[model samples]
Target: MRSLKNAFAAALLLCSAMASAHRFHAGITDISFNARTGNTEIVHTYMAHDVEALLANLYGRQFDLTDPDDQDVLRKYVEGRFWIGGQDKARLPLRWVGMTADPEKVTVFQEIEQTPLWKAGAIHDNVLIDFIPDQVNTVNLNEGNAVRTLTFDRNQLEQPTR
Candidate 1:
């Protein structure tokens, strides 16, 4: 009995430590970016599972997760501000940002934190970010100063092809 208790206690401690070390943050999902004529278009999405769990993980409280409300909160924040390249903030800070949602989908487009593809771990969710905002713009961007850590589960990335 004592040996069993000792083994359980050690297992519990190890599990706790690992969980703390890798609490899921937030990051971009199903995202694509394109630029045209000095105007940039950033497209990113959120999964139904992400909004509640990831937000609660980061903020320590469950936000009002209504489809429309969740979409709005996320859209406004990304549109209003983003870190881009060497610039201090949103490269093309929008005058306005918009959100629209159906039962289980949210989409956003606005100025984004843009970066080059060579960056290691340079993308995140909870915000919109564009890659190579200008093919001819000739500016090399870095991802060293991202605002939030985004998490994409291996399970999702490894979904069985249908």
Candidate 2:
């Protein structure tokens, strides 16, 4: 019984250590064009802790996840890191909407107006890449009825969103 208890305690400690060391470094972005509104909507989702860590490193200050000022800072940071281009390779204008944060995650929303329907475009997403070397950012582009996925990592920074 003593040996079994010791083995269980050791296993629990190992699991806790592994979990702390292997935090996931990733984020997901969803983009869709609204025909009725004539706008392209973009939503980016990230882990709250990861975003807080980023804010601290970038601004040299601690930020409350639910604070409005902190959220604005996050919005500006995300907008600067994310970019989209049309078929002509001209940068599309992005209008920041807002962001919402819960204990688990934070989601930021933005929009680009007057985008043509079903047009091919490209996106450059470098969110969290500067802070985390292994960060993986995945973008999902939704057309009228179809959805396409693009993945960006340390090796590949941008991709076509067709």
Candidate 3:
């Protein structure tokens, strides 16, 4: 009977640890066009722990996000994964501005300097889908007064920002 109680306690501890280590696969991206600046702003937010784990798995080493080298790697990764296409189907250039990391989330700021003079465009956001199969990224495109939202996962890679 004592052995049974000890086994139950061990099982409970194992479950608790697993729960604590589990990562939520989700991110949010807000895209807005500024007529005054003639540029498009992008703010991408993700859970810091999830991003760290994903980068660790990809690079075969743990990344300290606060480190400049680690941040450069992350910035490069994001630049390649996320994109916007203009009316001619040409990819819009995304320039990484900076990033902010809180305890819970990491937010990246980017901008498309040459604004596309189109009513609609295509947005490709594959943030963590390469490392996380169950990853879900929600993108909000704000064009003038209208806001359009699209959710991307493993199945859907890009969506029209119309």
Let me know the TM-score candidate 3 reaches against the reference structure: 0.84
Candidate 3 overall Cα lDDT vs. reference?
A: 0.85
For model 3, residues 1-162, the per-residue Cα lDDT tens digits are 999999999999999998977556899998888788887888999998888888888889987778888899999999889988886677887888899887789999998886743534788889899888999999987766788789999999988765
Using all chains and alpha carbons, the TM-scores for the candidates as numbered come to 0.36, 0.85, 0.84
Q: Cα RMSD (Å) per model?
A: 13.0, 2.6, 3.1
Among these predictions, the greatest lDDT belongs to: 3
Model 1 ranges off by over 4 Å: 23-39, 43-61, 64-66, 83-162
lDDT of 2 by residue, 28-142 (tens): 9998988889988989999888888899998899898677878788878887889998788877888898888887798998898887535546788999997899899999888
lDDT scores of the candidates, listed in order: 0.39, 0.85, 0.85
Encode model 1's per-residue lDDT on 1-162: one tens digit a residue.
Answer: 999999999999999997786343333433223333333334444444444454566568766644567656655555443323222322333322455434454555553334322222232221322211111111122223433323334222211101
lDDT of 1 at 113: 37
In model 2, state the lDDT of residue 20.
94
CA shift of 139, model 1, Å:
12
On the 0 to 100 scale, the lDDT of residue 137 in model 1 is 13
Q: If the candidates were sorted by their TM-score against the true structure, best first, what order would they fall in?
A: 2, 3, 1
* TM-score preference between candidates 1 and 2, better one: 2
